[model samples]
Target chain A: MTNIITICRKELKSYFSSPIAYLLMAMFAFLFGFFFWNAVGYFVSMSFQAQMSGRTIPMDVNEMIIRPLLMNVSVIGLFLIPLIAMRLFAEEKRSGTIELLLTSPIHDMEIIVGKWLAATILYACLLGISALNILFLFAYGQPDWKPLLIGYLGLILQAGGLLAIGAFISTTTKNQIIAGAVTFGACLMLWVLEWVAGYETATWATVLSYMSVVRHFEPFSKGVIDTRDLVYFASVIFLGLFLTARSLESLRWRS
Target chain B: MIKVEGLTKRYDRTVAVNNISFEVEKGQIVGFLGPNGAGKTTTMRILTCFLPPSEGTASVAGFDVLQSPMDVKRHIGYLPENPPVYPEMEVEEYLTFVGRLKGIPKADLALRVREASEKCAVAEVSKKLISKLSKGYRQRVGLAQAIIHNPDVLILDEPTAGLDPKQIHETRDLIRSLAGAHTIILSTHILPEVEQTCDHVVIISKGRMVAKDSVQNLTSRLRGQEAVAVEVTGGDNAAIQQRLEQVAGVSRVVARDTRDGRHSYEVESLPGCNVRGDVARAVVESGWNLHELRAVALSLEDVFLELTGAGQAAEGEKQ
Candidate 1:
């Protein structure tokens, strides 16, 4: 446990000490704000049109503005998650500090979990920007607090799954650029896999569609909780981290 | 403190270190002498638990490197050819991180870092960024990292590879001071460095053990014969050379350089012979000037070359 914290602390320090963390946070904040502005503009203009049409209908602030806005935030995360995890193991290997870590008296799991935890925290910090924008809604109007919290929860879980995958990819190479580009490609594939279900209803198609991370995330955006979605995210996290541990073990032989 | 037996590491079809075995006793500083790509670094990696041997076993501090690597790692410290330092980190911060990772207690972390930095001569640059420091300083910082935990064994690969003469001297002093508290195995191609620092020497060539013995013993073991050189002037060079070769128990005499009034000759005597007195008496009695006469013992450089066989032909020509 102490080894985990030690590695985690050092990983976090390296992240913040370089320009990578600040640059990632700033870029994420700008893009998320732009998406939030577009979502709110469309919602406000539609509300005004309804007022002029003499139709007494209600609009859900959560569904109209926050859901799509959070969805856009998850999209932005797909791009930035690669950046968060690319340097975790890749940079260490390039600089030869992997020798130090491997020779130290720490278990391989401790190092992997420590690095994954640090990446998850950085992803959460990026998600915090969307929460700041959500706080603006709470200040002006009545948005149901439970659904917003659940929406944020779903976003974090999705980030955890993708970031774990990125961490695993980072271990396979010593070049951060290759690690980042490959992780982005993998995450994008996971997002578009739900399209398989649109045209076919076969068992393989259904299974592949259910494997889509985006499919699992859709229920969370609708402010609905499901056991299957939780299980999906948990399994992805476990598998990604398990593969990372295996890659680290195989390194001794390959090198 | 360390033992390796029948260790072999093969990468694909290339065998890196092949069937080599040696042991290091406690409280001794052994030097690993080898040419480039001689598998010295590969051997050290196996001992440090960074790589596993393909065919045999290695143990450090009573733990097998393959079966109980964590226990071996806890007791061993290593410095590879390149110093493994993070450029973005401060020296003190890096040492503290290594200390914590090596399982140092929270209460003792600070003291261990301080002791390590001072011992390695990196105390003054503790707060400086590593990338800004020069290569020599970076090497010293790497040394500091290895000694931070005060492990039972230290495996250093080319520890003084990039240092200036003064830093090399200080590092040698520090390494000597570290003996008895820590058993050290440092590899270097510098022969004189080994002669100066190592109590025992292990020579490897092309992944095989060529020679392993004490520095004094290895040098004396060359040819098992005593050598003497004599300088005589104001005499016929050929006649003096032939006369010296006739001395009792003298095997051969090779003429060396000659100046205006002095000529040097290298004379080799048979095993268990003392012909220095006989050679000196012959030169004086022949009415020629006897300038200098002394026995010449082989240096570590000659022993290393002759043992490794990398430059054996050239060494033979020189002799």
Candidate 2:
């Protein structure tokens, strides 16, 4: 456990020190902030101007404020997580530093988890930086903190699933470019599975949608912590990590 | 202590290492000799537990490599042909990381890193990033990392593969300093390095172990004839040569003219025949002054060529 934490600390330090990590953070924040304003502007145009009002439209600041913030974080995270996780194993393998790690007393599982935890913490910190927007929303109106908390939880769950997939892709090759591309491709395919469900037949669509990470994220983003959704994300993370461990174990024999 | 029995590794259809068996007792510096692609690296990798052998078994310090890989890893320090190093890391940081990975106690990690840095002569570059260091310094750092754990066996594949003459001498001296305490198996293509450093030489060719024995015995066996070169005066060259050839146990003789018109005869006797007395008597009876006569022994280079079938005629002529 100490070894894991030590490796994790060093990895996190590396992420902070490299310009790539900082550049990704800046881009994510800018895009997320821009989308949040657009979402709020749309809600305002819908509520005012005496458009069509038969039902009581709850276009409160909470919907205009919290939902957009959560939605922005999730969407921006789709691009940001893979960039940080791309070098987890790919760089090490390319430089032959994997031999050092593999020959260590620590198990392969520890190395995968250490690098994943590093990326996860960096993602959380970037998300935390956007909390200033949430604080401003709190000053204007009574927004339920539950949705914000659930929104953050949803982002964590989604990012955990993406990170697992990213970790596995990093193990498939020593080229960071290929690792990044494959990870983005995997994440994008999974994200589009919900949309694909609309065209496919009912049973096939349901099964695909169940596997879709964004579908499982919906319950968490709506201020409801469904145990089923949490389990789904956890399972995805575990399965990816397990595959990564197996791949690492078998690389010597295959090579 | 190291023991290998029928160990082999094949990559697809190519046999990188055939069934080769050898042993190293505690405190012996053995040289792994072979040309490129001769399975020296493959055999070392198997001994270090970096790769699984396709067949047979090897044990280091009584730990079976196949059955107890972790134990084998803990007991061996392996330096591959190319030093596997992280260029971005500072020397001390990299050594500390390796020390920790090798399961050195935390309390002693700093001390071990310091000792290793000093021993490998990388103490001055301990704080410098490895990328900034020269190749020789980087190789030294590699050696430091390999020895940081103080494993029972050290398997170095071409430790002096690329270096200047001075650096090679320095590296050889360092390896010699670690002789008694570390059971080292170093591989090299340089023949003289084996004669100079190793007590025993294991020559591999085409993925098979061709010869394994002490350097002295190998040379003696290859020295098939008891050769004696004699420079004599006051003799007809043909008569002296013929008389020497007719001597008992003398298989052949060749005569040559020295610069001062003195005749030199090279006498080749049958194996195990000490005909130095007969050759001297024959030369004297032919009314020639026996200026010099001694048994000429074979050099290690001769043995290497004969055993590996390289430049054999050239070695014979040099005699």
Candidate 3:
């Protein structure tokens, strides 16, 4: 456990010390901020029109503004997660430091987990920036903090699932550009799987849609914590990390 | 101690290390000498647990590399051909991370990093970013990380590869100082380095062990068929050569034209014969002013070329 933390600490330090981390953070914050502003503006226009028409429809701030914003954060994560995870293993291999890690006494699983944890933390920091944008909604309007917390929870779970897959893909190559492009392709495919449910309701189509990470995140985005969704995200995270460990083991043989 | 038996590493169609075996006693510095692509790096990688041998076994400090790699890793410090360093990290931070990876206790981590930096002479640049440092400083930083935990064995591959001559001398000295406390296996193709630093040398050619012996013994073993060079002046060249060949145990004599009017002859004697005294006496009795006469012992360079050249010739014929 200490070995894992030691690796995690060093990995995190490297991320922040490079220009990549800050560049990622700024891009995520700017994009998420744009989505937040649009959601708030749409919500205000709807409330003003409803009031002028003398309608008594009650609009919940959490439902009207925060939910769509959380979903937007998830979409933005599809682009951002690849950038964060691409360097985890690819940089190590390119720089020849993989030799140091492989020949160290630490287990392969520890190294994988440490690197994944560091990438996840950076993703969380990105999410935290968007969360600050949501804080303004709480100060003025009467928004329920509980559902906002659940929406952010959904964003994190979704990010965790995608980042793990990106981490696994990063281990397959030494070129960070290739790693990033392939991971982006994979995350896009996962996001587009839900379109299969719209076209056909066949058993195969349903299975494909069920595998889409977006489906599992729906309940949490609506302020409902379902154990089934938790299990799905947990399974995805486990499968991704398991594959990463196997990749690292194969690297020992092929090196 | 280190032991390898019939170790082989094959990458697809090419065999990098083929059926090589050797041993290193405790507290001995063994030089793994071979040309580029001759499997020196492959052998070191196997012992360091970076890769497993495709066949046979290797053990370091009583732990089999394939069976108990973590144990073997715990006992060995390895520096690959290129120094593995994080460009963004300061030297002290890099050393600290490697120390922790080597499982040094938290309390002793700072002290160990300091000691390692001082040993490798990178203490003054401890705060500088690694990418900003010069190549020699970066190489020393790599060495500092390897020795941060002070393992029982050190496996250094081309540790002095890209350094200047003074840095190479200092690195060799540092490696020599580490002897008697650590069993080190340093690999290089430079002949004089092995002669100057290593007590024992294991020469490999085409992934096969060609020779393994103490440095002195390897040279002396090839000294039996050595040549003697004689320089004489103020005599007819043909008469001088004729008289030199008449010495006891002299088998063949070849004379070369000299620019300064001195007659130079390379005399080959029968195996195991010491004909320097006889050649000197014969030249003196002939009234030729003998300027220089000495039996030329085979240098390590000659022995290395002869052994590897034999392997190349065999390979050529097979192909």
Candidate 4:
């Protein structure tokens, strides 16, 4: 446990020391805040509201403005997570530090878990900053804490799954650019699989659509946490992380 | 102590190290010498447990590399050809990370880091980022990391590869000081380094062991009878050569003359023969003015060339 935590702390320090983390965070925060303010103005302009009681606003109005903004933030996170996780092993291998780490006393599982947890933490920070929309809406209208919590859980789980996929892609090659591309390609395929499933007419296609990250996220966004949705997200995260571990194991022999 | 028997490593169809066997006693500083692409790095990697041999077995400090690799790794400190460094990290942070990775106890970690920094002469650069360090400083940091845990065995591949002459001398002195405490296997192409530092030498060529012996012994084995060149000013070249050849125990004599009118003869004799005095006496008796007489000593380069030739001849015979 100490080994894993040591590796995790070092990894986190590396992220902060690098410029990419700061650039990604600044871009994510600015874009999401700008889109949310624009969304608020658009939704209010479309409403036919006269000067009502100063203290009252429709509950659905805040949801209408905040949901699209937060959902867009989630979409942005899906792309940015790959950028952060791409260097986890790819850069290490390119620099030959993988040999140093693998020959050390630390277990392979500890190294894998440590790097994955670090990437997940960075993704959480990005998602956490975007969650400011919930607080922004609460300032003007009564907001449901239950739905917000559920949605945040879903975001974290989905980000964990995406980060594992990125980690797996990183182990496949030593080039960070190729790793980033492959990670983006993998995530983009899964994300678009649901849209592709929409065109099929069979029950299996509907099941495949249910496997999409979006389908599990819908229940959470509605403040309804179903056991089935929880199981689906958990399974994806587990399989992704398990594959990542296997990739690292194969990497020792490949090099 | 370390032992390797019938260890072989193959990449695809090309063998890198083939059935080579060697052992090192507890405090022997062994110099691993080979030409480029002679599998020194591969063997060191296998010893460090960074690589597993395709066939055969190896053990370090009584732990089998294939069975108890973690224990083997715990006992060995390895410095690869290129120092593995995270350039963004400061030297002190990198050393601390290495100490922890090597499983040094938390209480002793800081002290060990300091001791290793001082030992490798990297203390002054501890707070500087790795990217900002000079090549010599980076090499010192690499050595510091390798020894921070005070492992029983130290493996350094090309430790002085890119250093200036002064740094090379300092590193050699540091390595000499490390002797008798840690068994070190340092791979290098510099013959003089082995002559100056190592107690035993292992020479490899084309991924095969060519020779293993002490430096003095290796040179002694190749040392032939000493030859003296003598130039006589006023004697018939043939008669002088004939007289020198007739001297007891003188095996052969070849005489050559310059266009400017001086004759030089090379006299080769058997071991325990000092024919120089005999040649000078003969030249003076023959009423010839002996201009110059000098004896030549065999150098390590001659020994190296002889071994490389032997290795090549053996390779040719196998083909």
Q: Give the least accurate 10-residue stretch of model 3 chain B, judged by summed lDDT.
A: B310-319
The ten-residue window of minimal lDDT in model 4 chain A covers A50-59
lDDT tens digits, residue span A1-255, model 1: 888888888888888999988999899889988988998899889989999998866888898988998788888888999999899899989988999999999999999999999888878877886788888888987889887778888988998899889989999999999999999999999999989999999999999999888898888988989999999999999999999999998888878
- What range of 10 consecutive residues in model 2 chain A has the weakest lDDT sum? A49-58
The DockQ leader among the candidates is 3
Ranking by DockQ, best first?
Answer: 3, 1, 4, 2
**Candidate 3 off by > 4 Å:** B224-297, B310-319
lDDT of 3 by residue, B1-319 (tens): 9999999999988899999989999999999999898999999999999988999999999999988999999999999888999999999999999999999999999999999999899999999999999888988998898889999999999999999999999999999988898999999999999999999999998898899999999878777886899999989888888898889999999785675889898899888899899999998888888898887766898889888995467546755
lDDT of 2 at B71: 88
lDDT of 2 by residue, B109-223 (tens): 9999999999899999899988899889888998998899998888888998888888888888988888888999999999888888899999998889989998778777856
Q: Of the candidates numbered 3 and 4, which has the greater DockQ value?
A: 3
Q: What overall lDDT goes with each candidate model?
A: 0.90, 0.83, 0.90, 0.83
Interface RMSD (C-alpha) of each candidate? 0.7, 2.1, 0.7, 1.3
Q: What is the TM-score of chain B alone in each candidate?
A: 0.87, 0.79, 0.86, 0.83
What does DockQ give for each predicted structure?
A: 0.69, 0.31, 0.73, 0.54
Give the least accurate 10-residue stretch of model 4 chain B, judged by summed lDDT: B310-319
Candidate 2 clash pair list? none
Q: A-chain TM-score per prediction?
A: 0.98, 0.92, 0.98, 0.90
Which candidate model has the greater TM-score, 2 or 4? Answer: 4
